[model samples]
Target: MRLTHSCIITNEVKKLSEFYEKVLQIKAETSGDEYAEFPTDCGILSIFSFSLQESLAKGSSLPGSNRNLILEFNVANVDDEYMRLEKLGVEFVKPLTTQPWGNRSFYFQDPDGNMLNFYTKVK
Candidate 1:
C-alpha cells in the first residue's frame, strides 16, 4: 500500500505545526484544535493531540519515542540548504557531509524532538 501521510502526536499541535511552517516553509491546515497537516510533495506531514488520538483509539499508550525515525527531505544542494536553515536558528546534529551511502546530508532536530535530514544523492 502507498503511504499518504506521516503523523506526529504532541500536546501542542499549533506550536509544532508552526515549526514546520516557519522553518521548512510548509503550509499547514488546522482541523479545529487537534490536527494540522502539511501537504508536501512526498506526502502529508500531520500532527495531532494525544488526547484526540486517545479518544479515537480507546486508550492507546504513547510510544516510548526513539531517534530511529527520520523525516528526510530531498534537496538539490545539501550545504546550501544547511546554510539557509541554520540562519533561521535550526539546531543541527550534523552538518553537510557526504555519507558512505553516496548522499550528502545535514541532520537536525524539529521542535517536537523529531530528527530531520535534508539530503541529496551525489553522482
Candidate 2:
C-alpha cells in the first residue's frame, strides 16, 4: 500500500501554506479559502483551515497537538539544506549531526511546532 498524503488541519491555511512554501521550496494549490495542498515528490502535504475542520465532527487542535510523530524529508545534502533553511530563519531543534546509523541528520520545527527531520544517508 502507498500513502498518498499526510494531512494537517489548522486554523491558518494560508499562513501554514506559506510556511511550507519556504521550508519545502514548493508551491501550494489552494482548493478554496480554507484549504491548500502541496504536491511533494513522495506525497501530498495538505493543510485545511478550521472552517473545514468545523464542518467535521470535531474541531482542529493543531500546532501543539502532536508530540510523538515526526515528519522527515530526505535531501541530497542535509548540511546544504540546513544552511539554506537557517538563512530563511528556520528554527532547529538539533544542528546537523552525523548519526551512527550512517545518516547525517538534523531536526527542526515548523511554524506550528511540527517536528521535522532533514537527513541524508552516508555510506
Candidate 3:
C-alpha cells in the first residue's frame, strides 16, 4: 500500500494554503471550498477542514490550542529555506543548525502551531 496524502485538521484552510504556497512555493490543489492540496512528486499534502467549536462541543478538542503533530519537509538547503521563509514571515521554532549526524536542520511552526522542519544533508 502507498500513502497518498496526510491531512492536518485546520480551521483556516485558506490561510494555511496561502502560507504554504507563498513560503514553500507549492501549488495547492482545490477540492471544493473546504480542502486544499499540495501535489508532491510522491504523495500530496492535504489540508482538511476542522471546527474548533464543534470539536470542543463534542469534547474532542483539548484544553489548549496546539495540536500534537509535527510535519517535516526534507529540503535541499535548510539554511537557505529557513532564511527565505523567515523573510516571508514564517516563524521558526528553532534556528537551523548542523546535526551530529551531518544534516543541517531547523524547525518552524505553521499558522495553527503545527511544528514543521526543513532539513538538508551537510556537505
TM-score against native, each model: 0.90, 0.92, 0.83
> Which residue ranges in model 1 land beyond 4 Å of their true spot?
58-64
Question: lDDT by residue for model 3 over 65-93, one digit each (tens)?
Answer: 66567767778777788889888887778
Tens-digit lDDT string for candidate 1 (1-123): 899998887777878888899766878898998999988887998888988888888566363264679999898878888888888899889878999989999898877678898999997
Each prediction's whole-model lDDT (CA): 0.84, 0.85, 0.77
Candidates 2 and 3 compared: the better one by lDDT is: 2
lDDT of candidate model 3 versus the reference: 0.77
- Ordered by lDDT, highest first, the candidates read 2, 1, 3
Top-lDDT candidate index: 2
Model 3 spans > 4 angstroms off: 51-67
- C-alpha RMSD between model 3 and the true structure: 3.2
Worst 10 residues of 1 by lDDT: 58-67
Q: What TM value does model 1 have?
A: 0.90
Residue 119 lDDT in model 1?
95
